[model samples]
Target: MFWATGWKPIVLAAAMLLASASSALAEEGVPTPGDLLAERLDERLGEQEVALQAFYAARDGRPAWQETATVAALANALRTLDADGLTPQDYRPDTLVAAHRQALAEQSSPAARARFDVQTSQTLLTALRHLQRGKVDPYRIDPGWEVPIEAPPLDLAAISQAVDARRFEQAFASARPSSASYERLRASLARYRHIARQGGWPMMPPRSQSLRPGELHDDVLLLRERLAILGELEVMAAGVSAGVEPQATEPRRYDERLVAAVERFQQRHLLEVDGIVGPRTRAALNVPVVTRIDQIRVNLERARWLLHGLPDSFVLVDIAGYRIRYFRPDGDVWRSRIVVGRPYRRTPSLRSSISHLTINPTWTVPPTILREDVLPRVRRNLGYLWQQDLMVLSPSGRRLDPRDVDWWRPGNVILRQRAGPRNALGRVVLRFPNDHLVYLHDTPAQALFAREQRAFSSGCIRVQGVLELAQHLFDDTGTEAEVSTLVAAGRTRNVHLERPVPVILHYWTVHPDEEGRLVFRPDVYQRDAALLEALDASPTR
Candidate 1:
């Protein structure tokens, strides 16, 4: 094989040094370097011993990390792991470099060289595995996560080939997620870390009253400085004048410009865009830059969890963001606000494909909702069933009188709402098969979508402009009209799509907007704390 010219001489020099080391070891009555390397591989590598052994066996049990250029490249790769929201100390690049230098100095000791070689290989493999999948498993952190974590199996052969070819950087890059969203978040992480290094924005003092436009308050000055540091405000220099006299208290006044900047900040944080700075807005602005950095890191870990091998087209439900985006092949995207499950009835993260759409769909209350929601209402007044247009049915699909059934111990019965304006599920329903029985559908309560934090559903997602989304998903010109006709006819009809579009119901507290700016959302499910705890924990391996 032809090695790259840049490192060919270094490889030859390392081979010669290895030969000299082996000859010296033989003179001292010690085993050959390859034999010692095989022994060290067995002792150091617990679960990965077989793979490392097989990798070395292909090269006649020779040490692969003898070349200084290869080890340096591995060290560089480990150092840059921080850019991916990974801790560089976890890989211990400095220790690896120091060990390599010491091994080179003691060229006569095959044992030292063998140990360094094994350590280098093990560290490289671990780093690659973490980059490809993640440091922590999703199932371990989130027991309710249902999305299948798909990652390419670790190929030691390919890694060895890359190291031999001296393409370590390219290999590490290929291991990470390739989606634009992941890359954007990675860039934001770097910027936020830089802000931390520069002593992040100052905290604003608490105030009981909201800061409205054209009002004067001392806290507004601190708010302006905070927003200015975040690039949301354009602050003129202290002495720079634009023909207007600068008053001492002018900055403290809640001017229109500062209000606009606050609105922008509120928009990015997924808070209400009102021009007034209320408690919620103040709380968001007062969040420490270090916390925001950690938020970016946590979401970066989340991006690694689900961004691999995405289809050409798919529907992504940003649960925490309270929004849905349907991505198409031609780069066109359709988006709408959505109401996800409440915090206690948290929406699960899963991947499924939308195969069909139901026009004028009926609503069936799930078991949990029935026990926790409907039973209480019905037990108080049997008239509640009639008010909600819910019909009680036996397990055999036989209709039962609501008055005769015992609401307290209603066993083996179903509560279904007929199709109408009062139905919980509105005019159209997008159906996908999953164990959770949660699907995206139109809701009668459209007012909920207007709220910034839309987490009102039992477990299913209530989508705004769902009919339009159904039109996009249909992907068939004729089926769109058919769906409209069925809905207008007020008849229950299921229309299968010509091509099933993949759907991913995901939870992300931070994601990049269209302009590539990071948008932070409330962790409504309170998932980030647990995930961050797991991520910061020591590696299980």
Candidate 2:
């Protein structure tokens, strides 16, 4: 019905209508493109809260980025965005609610269970309680290895530095206390010193200075308490014989024997071998019984957040102490020492399921590995690949005549290694698809397990006991007997998997044990500072 001139008017009118619609959307809280992107990030972050909360609780006895703040920020974003109209595609409030209810059902006692439910609900509503200002957890490990004490002349900087190290010496040096208060503190120190005289501190080697700023908040407190408690533990350990067993020998153990036992306990707890108890060890020993109870509560919260909604089975890699643990549906089933990636090439945090396992696996070297390690060796000596039993393949699938490509040119080339005894992947590979290009595999370098410190891999975990692990995974698949037979033969057999387990590569440097005693592990990867800042600045729920 319109001519060419009439069409121009129609176009203008359409343009106006579109602009009006856009304006209306803006007024209704539909964010701009930039804001929309932020919203998307917030959405994904919201989903990550469960795992994040678990990590936080494990590391600091509370969520690093408080759940309360997160939830509040999310709510604000939702309000600003008018998310009701947009609607979340993959998220469901009812699903979270159902999960909450299921967790509540799992608690054994009604009162205890109610408390658990309250905590969970708190996490949901408030975000989380992150950093409590000025209230440092006494259980944390010392960030600085040693506190620098100021002597005759007061060095304020030196005193402050020492105070930061969790050393009481600095406290005394910095004391501007009233005479009465000073006297009281002096008396406490004297009492501590008296205990130190009778019982030596749990002697521990000088801890490395590489620990991250905030990863060990709870651990620092625990360490302090452990130091306090060491005197007691020493007394207990020196004299405390193993409790009488109905099926066993002695009715009671003597005090000297108990001291010996305490020494053994010190060794097991990673404390120094000094037979004497000092202030540090004494403090650790004097940990109040109530603190252990608190540890249990914190660990419970962690389990609820981390393991509550998880799949039936997965691989858990504890990065701090460099250990790998496997969990089956039944219970705490299996564990092994693993050589994780080095600090420089850190293993990542991710969730993926192992889809397959390859026996006598051919190693198709990842591009990064080739560039960083293999290529340099190849350049230095052409025989490097042949020595390692590796083969160079062209894109066309032919054996790359190494002569064809200019050896000196930076280029693209596929490198594969034939499976044999010398293969880097050793006898097996657990395949899990992930962005980190990581997997669990056997390593030819098995001797590294003998060292106390084991952070030496490129990124993949080099498991110490792959043979046993393989047997365990293949038990239900009926391949365990066959695998064992193959191992006996020692010639290597390539076997594909029938079913694969899930692998969760995570980074947690602190955790509590069954006895509710908080434990410390080396923070092999430094990743706490940025996280701490993020935690501190995050909005409160």
Candidate 3:
């Protein structure tokens, strides 16, 4: 009876529409189907209050279309839904006349209304962001989706298999390096593997008999052996975690060569490289198979997040691994092994835009350096400033008497000091506005970069290839030729940048190679443990 009652008015309205169309046909001015449909849809869904009340009432039965919570909520939903384009299923005066009455009835029923409005008002904002990003389709609704309370991206399938196997060998043998710096580990193994394949072990770098360092020979040999073990572990670990067939082709088992292999893994990871597997070494090895996978995923997400929207050129410093990479929009163009600050002077993580580059830049000893370094020296020796080639400057750039100003006075330490050849900043300063007071600059201590582990600076990054970087930044200004000329001239020259490229100093504990093999670097700042904990605790993968 109710359905029949609703159909009567709708059918009458359709008849009236047919008569009107016949008249329009006689007048030779008939509206197009698209135009007529647009008008009808707009009438049904375009008006804010009416559409909202209609949707609210449609959810349940209401006898009278009066102002009610259901109507208010439906109106809110209609207003919030992305309206770039939407269609209405019905639009006829007769149909609307009865449906409108039903909407009123629906609005009156409390049971018809939702307890809480689930439609977010930010749908328009999301669509706008997508449009700015050049998205095509605006709305994609999936009714079958269920919200996840918590999940991890780790390969649970492999982990389940690993657990099912009930063997640490499967877990350990299947592990692989998960950061960029570990590429050398793979390379080193390849070198040795090739040597072995040729039926000979590679010769170790010769240190003379006279230079026999005590307590170092066995450890060095052991470290080399450990390096080999790490390579084997990586191949095994990756294979197991990938749920691929085990590549356990090694004639020598890691357990059989445990003493030597564990040592090498420790040596490379910067843990105590003792042949014995202690708590620290075990902790390093015991990094859950899932944890490393999660770490790689997180780093990939971060790389995507940071590098996705960057300009055509930018310099990024990864602190946890103590390396800086120069990337063009095309991809990574240049990279270098960098020595970041020590634990005490840990390099900061930040976002910065490079303001300028000063070639042969003079080091202005910062107050922290002055207090921690110069002041202590001044206290030790009265002639410390002159000995170090430091010039005391007043606020006006005039040289102040080092003796006149009380070295120990808190006020005296506030003065800016001009640095000369022997200054802390060796020859250049890459300037950026950052509160960390850190920058990429030349260091007089060039030999430190040559060390295997380059975590040597205070809080700044020490570039191993500073001149190469300088050349890249000053491509337009003949800085490359100028720096070359100065070096040949055997004199230091200060050159200012014509245009500076922005440099970002960041920290990444893990990164991948071109082949997508993940490598792990030493947690130079000891950041991995905490990050690992956080990653494990995250509700989302």
Candidate 4:
């Protein structure tokens, strides 16, 4: 709104003239026009007053938007903010363009020019800040978010200098997260936006029976069209080539080629590769293109939150996607499936370094798991303790018989499982320091890893192929033989790493796959709604 209007030319000119003359006419030093304009800018910058004042003072109170090329560069940058999943309207690009035009008009006044300068600077600074850190502070919305997003302090003086040198484009590029993942998501956003502009893909009608290969149905036409729109299907030009009849071109028939395309679609969506049009696959297909666009946008903001300042090599736990990746410095990446916490006991997002690994680890049942999970089953049957190979211990480290204790009030006593084949933490535990006390470990319940949506753990992560991951973390420190011996002997041991590897336990419902295509996962913890609400709200200064 500040850049929407201009002051009357005659009155503003007369005030400027009087203010300039007052410098010569002052008995008690009157403020000049530039000083008055600076005062106006300070008043407009509420909390940012100090930084902005320093910015202008370094330039001797001169306007930063004097150059037409600089202004045009900034305007162009603001217009393309949508590529970064930012709403251009939030930065007032239309108002900026209009005000810039008015400032360059024949009857423009100094007041109008000063307003344009202050408002344009504020808009650019806000956009840059959002691009650097994020529009929403993740902690404000989700208190359990523990990843440190310490925004780098803004050096307004340097920014002012860059603008003066007409290096606004370079400054903006430097402000954004420079990760390949971010760039891929931006490209995916553009593709999805283009899909939406073309009226999106068609939705198929509901059917009772599952559609398999060699089936003929009217809804197959919609399915073919939908898959083709998403580039998952290659529509054959109306001619047979190999192992095909002329009727294979019929849209109503679900032939072998269609089955292959369906498998590809399933793979992209992380669904079963059976190629049958079942309920889950159908639901995935019917998701509107606009909704997919928002999914990419939401993940773009997420990428902004944590993609910067990464170490050369670290482990990334993609909670929602049920996978973890180990990035090596030599551009090699190792990945495996994982089982994260369930919805009710949602795993927290955090950053910490893996300090060491515990081999043949025993499970000291956490308090919450003891109360809600173990005690209930033990109360139903006292033999549950023996079945689980758990030992009951007193507060003073003395072993107690389960039959001698009261199941109704097992106060202060600890339940620890012996290190064995049936132990909950199978053979290894990757420990990290955090208030939540969760870690990555091997699980005997490896069947859960086969699930498409693996959220079965209490809070800690159960990793598949954990031994391979531990060996990689060791980084050829010659401890592989010792680890194997200790694990085979069933002896408890802690193996400190040669150097601690950083680990980030994060949640993301959309991310790029190995091929750089976007993979949309389910919002298992229902976090997207709150974040989407915060992002859609009017931005703050």
RMSD of each: 5.4, 23.2, 16.7, 5.8
Question: What's the TM-score of every candidate structure?
Answer: 0.87, 0.50, 0.51, 0.87
Worst 10 residues of 2 by lDDT: 130-139
Q: For residues 356-438, write the lDDT of model 4, one tens digit per residue.
A: 99999989899999999999999999889999999999989799999989989999999999998999999999999999999
> Over 4 Å off in model 1, which ranges?
1-62, 101-112, 152-167, 236-249, 476-481
Per-candidate local distance difference test: 0.82, 0.50, 0.48, 0.83
Candidate 4's TM-score reads 0.87
The candidate maximizing lDDT is 4
When sorted by lDDT, best at the front, the candidate numbers are 4, 1, 2, 3
Residue 327: error of model 1 in Å? 1.3
- Tell me how far the alpha carbon of residue 409 in candidate 4 is from the true structure, in angstroms, after superposition: 2.0
Predicted candidate 3 versus true structure: per-residue lDDT over 302-387, tens digit per residue: 34224324446778787776667786545547888787888777787666666565554556677677777667878889887766
In candidate 4, stretches whose alpha carbon ends up further than 4 angstroms from where it belongs are 1-61, 67-73, 98-116, 150-162, 165-168, 236-249, 476-481
**Cα lDDT tens digits for candidate 2, 397-497:** 67877767676674667888887778888887777877677888899998887765578888888898987877777774444455556645555455655
- Ten-residue region with minimum lDDT total, candidate 4: 236-245
Query: Residue 504 of candidate 4: its Cα lDDT?
Result: 97
Candidate 1 C-alpha lDDT tens digits along 1-541: 4568878999999999999998999899888746776676556544556657666655566578888888888888788888988888888878776788898685546667767787777777778878888888899877777888777665666667888888887778778888899889888888988888989988878888888898977787687778767877766424113465664557778877777888888889988899888899989988999999989999989888888878878999999999999987677889999999999988899999998888888888888998888899888988999999998899888999887887777888999999999989899989899888999999889988888888899889999999888877765323445557678899887888877889999999999988888899999999999888887776654
Positional deviation of residue 143's Cα in model 1 after best superposition, in angstroms: 1.3
True lDDT of residue 349, candidate 2: 61
